[model samples]
Target: MDMQDIENKYNKLIIRIPVFLGLALALGIGIGFMISIPRKNTVSEQSSKITEVLSLIQNNYVDSLGLDSTANFAIQKMLQNLDPHSSYFPSDDAPLAKSQLETDFEGVGIEYEWVKDTLFVLYPAKNGPADKAGVLAGDKVIAINNENLAANTTQNTLFKKLRGKKGTSVELTILRGKNIQKISVIRDKIRSYSVYAYAINSEIGFIKVSKFAEKTDLEFTEALKKLVEKDKVKKIIIDLRDNGGGFMDRATKIADEFLEAGNMIVYTKGKHKRYDQEYLATKGGIFEKGDVVLLIDEGSASASEILAGALQDNDRAILIGRRSYGKGLVQVPFELSDGAEMRLTVSKYYSPSGRCIQRDYKNGKPYDKNLVERYKNGELLHEDSIHYDSKQVFKTKKGKKVYGGGGISPDYFIPLDTTDLSTSILNLMRENKLREHASLFAKNNKKILIEMGLDKFDKGWQIEINTFRNIVGNISMNTTQSDYLKLYYKSYLAKVLWGNEAQIQIRNTQDKAVLKALEVLK
Candidate 1:
């Protein structure tokens, strides 16, 4: 019990404790490293195996192939094996896609509608190469650089021959206004105005945005300015039908235009990053208080969903038409080492109201079956047949109950109508009778057809039923009731002499959805 003996015992105890604690920690570290080391080695081995396989394929193939194409194809095949959404774009395709998404390209700018291997100019872009070259609307491109493009050339081949670097010249043999004339058009850098028609009619401004490209917000702002300059617009209709989507930033920008300051437009979260970016509207805007309506359909996707969801949740616009295409997944384009790109799904996009508009794609299965399943369950034909997610619900800014897991359900549901679609018409279209007849009629009256403008032709063109019937009768004279077929051919002939737009207008005159939209707008 001496003091010196107690002090010596305490010091020894402390030293022993330190030694034991250090040994325990070392053991734990050793165990952790042992577990992880195998996984690291396995991954490394797999990577080596992939490299070996690729090398083997490169060195020993059944046929001689371009190494660049083979590498790109391998990348594409690898992505395809992973998921349906992940896609690869080769070098040649990348530029074209980049130009399209960025809303700029080098070419003669004209929206041409293809029919029966012939390119007919729909409308020349203002201040575009085609416009500068005096390439009028309704002109037919017969040849390009001594090659008869109208004969049997595919559109892809023709576009390759036409599109080139900026300032490059393309010589075209065009049949314009009843004259076969050759014209040279120097291809220039063409910027696509996403908002095509921006005008004010009777104090109501109209701005039509075709796609959510890179220049969408800029173009949209310009459109708003133009419309406001013409007259004060009280109402606006944003057409989102058939637009598949584009840049996510553009969607956020567009949504920010309508929402109030500090409002959440959209927020995305992933495993690696918990991104909660809040997009706010700037102070100045043209139609902050004006009425807005959004038109949507099954074709409307990703960026379109962002726009519709933001506007809807904020009570900024009345949504019209059918349910949107539920594509709430965010895709990040990763450029491969071999000049190829892969669009991989990195995150899921959510609306301001916290609704993920993406439908179920569990088990690595494609969710494209949703629409077809909906149709089979009798959704498209009638509004009553539509199903909503009753269990999963989110509240809007105004406390309205909104569902998740599917798509943006419009405030007003418009049923798809198929009244005018007949078996006879479908048969004729499928058999290429309509296209064939139009080509024949155009050939016979090429001189007269070239002189007609879209407006005049759309308004004045009528089928001479008797003349059409006689022509049809002459073609199928040997068969019985061939004479009766002539009248049917005549009716379609009127559609051909005009444009496909005219035909669509005539056919969709009784469309329930379009009529419903107009009625709601009015």
Candidate 2:
């Protein structure tokens, strides 16, 4: 054939496909289509198929699967990848954790500590059921309701035994000064104080709250009355370091005492919203007009932010300390189908002046690393080193400029004091050697330590340096030490055994932030 005729024949052959051969190929394609998913479908269909495969394994696999736990764990992993603060508390942990942030819990009304295997009574709240029944400190718990305590019983186990619904009776067999006696006590609502008010030298009223709980407002009022009116306290120093956060309502209640009514305390909003919801100060305050100073540091967050923000904004209180840990998300608890709950961030909380004290949290980026970044940038060391992004500025009612998208900046930046810190102390603390040493010290000198009052122990006490040295000498490590480290360890051990307040007293002596706050009040 000629070249043109051959080309025409080739085109016709391609179209025909040998008739029967083409029919067989088409039949095979149709059969494959009947069994397999179409390639033209969206990617979602492929994901659904993979999910179904996993579900099958979870349901009818050879081994029984913990499907709920697996799913929650997966969710937790996903959230962790987002931010450190975005944590998932499972059903078992949620109640216990939530109680600490709230006002009260159902438990026997007594504070106790475990020394070795014995439980030592610390303090009983005044008018509390335990106190009414005459439970005192230094008393030891030997048994509960005639049941001999299991050998090496942990404090947590003891707590589980003691804590129950109100009106429930828990019998405690006590060992008091070599005398054993059994006492039946009624379980009641244990109200934890958010504000502890006392006078320092009859002049400065000290109110140190660990966090803002549900009953913080009422507690604050009672505390203020006891401190200011009853004790005749003049200036107030509110310490809020290491207080991560709690109820915002309680924060506003505390702030209202310092701020006049109608002042905007804080605001909140999200992406879909335009104008923010503002929380303002209402009527009725315990100390509507008083000289107040607030203490803050890197650990202060959320509700702590609200109180600090309001106090700072209203100029009613002088904020003295380092910058706070900015965490401005407001979380709401939602229960899953499995009784497990998730504290989902509902909105971004803003200070009264429209400053969102939440630092940037972008997807796939590190959030907790901000503190390290701040330290490297010298923000922890000096106020001058703090540079604000001009674009994220907000102004207080008084027109004082404040920055958003970060934590609340203290009016007075107190540099972190590492003067007393040493490699020896840090190592001991991290390794829990100090705790062990405290236990030993308590066992040996229980009576002698008890005789020494907290005040006397705090003032004249020196940690048994030789004992500490002997312990440290036994430790197999190469770490430098200082005179302060040796003495500090001794003091810390004494504090842990003698009383928890002892450590605070010792730490207060060297805490630059506390001193700075005191100076501001003065």
Candidate 3:
């Protein structure tokens, strides 16, 4: 196209080219938008279909159906498909679920055990409703509110009868020896402890954390203060075995107590940016300088794993016991319009070493029977049986090798103690014979136990072999098993006389995990 005459034509052609390109791009954009609309509509349509079906069933069904219950069940099933941890709680169960992690609850406040289908009071909470109404330990509860407790009556039924709104009263028919008495107890708020601390020795402290509740961090801080300042303990053993876990914040706060400032304890990532969070340790840690030995087992999950992972990744504590429960997902509770609750898994947390604690559940694995599977695979008895993801290996702050793909593995592995757990022992435990015997013994020696006191009783008390033989009957056991049974009976007697702390202390005298922790601390 050359020179002055072609230049004018070329300019016009270039201008037309720009308009042509704009039209082509617009057409492509329109097609893209058309393709994306169906994906959005598909989700909307599926949701509408569920609602339509529910409405149809509610309006035109032959028999009247509780739509509320149906909807709750449907929601629960849908959440189950998402993950094992996400769950839906009905209105009636919602409060009970939330109350588990609360510091206080309204009830008559008596810890009881079912022996041979009869409920026997282990002990009443001091100054609580049952205690104030003269509900003595070792008394048999025969009826509640005049409703006789049949042999088939479930403990849950009795639990419901005992728990009611604050300031309400319940009548309990108690049988003590040959006499039956009716006692009325007014329900009141009863305080609960998540943290239990005692001196393991003059220089070592033992703290058992049952769960990470709303007041867990505060309670732990108080226990830490008493151990460090009052008891002059330089070493601490934190027992997290059987702690199913509760609040993440509570666990992180406790972890912060042992971590230095500016350290990253854990971090979480999710689908939404708002759910992404990084937890860092703050200043003024209470037990930062002490030697810490953390004990965990298969029952420890969620917040317990977070605490263990933090301490392990930072190389701040020596972990002892079997591998913990693998639950790295973080759930956020949502209150429904009908007063129900939905706990939805929002995020997956990672330790400071960049290892995700969640196990493989999407690969056709049975998530609910994980512990059973672990036992079958011999992971509990042998540390070498544990399957580690070689691809998920990560390094701790101190350059220690740690693995992901599942729970936090302890530095020192202690196999599960199945010794002394014979068939006879199991049968005795199943029938609650030991507890029944202990209750009877405590009832007969109530005056003696009170007068002797816990300290003296702990020092000089022993369940006679003949007394144990009477409870055993024809059930045969070796010396070791017999000794273990006798020790457990003594512990139960301590429980009936004193409380849970006394029982724990007496049991710890020969507990394998506690002994291992002591060895590690030493």
Which of 1 and 3 is ahead in TM-score? 3
Output the TM-score of candidate 2.
Answer: 0.70
Q: Order the numbered candidates by lDDT, best leading.
A: 3, 2, 1
lDDT (10s digit) by residue, model 1, range 150-257: 556654576687778888988888875467988899999887756643322354554556567767878887776666665566667677776666666777777776
TM-score to true structure, per model: 0.72, 0.70, 0.88
Which lDDT values do the candidates have, in the order given?
A: 0.62, 0.65, 0.79
Across 72-161, the per-residue lDDT of candidate 2 in tens digits comes to 787788666654445565676555445555457877777675555566665555567776675655467778878777658854467578
Poorest lDDT segment (10 consecutive residues) of candidate 1: 20-29
Off by over 4 Å in 1: 1-44, 114-116, 132-136, 139-143, 147-156, 173-182, 197-203, 274-276, 363-377, 417-518
Candidate 2: 10-residue stretch with minimal lDDT: 20-29
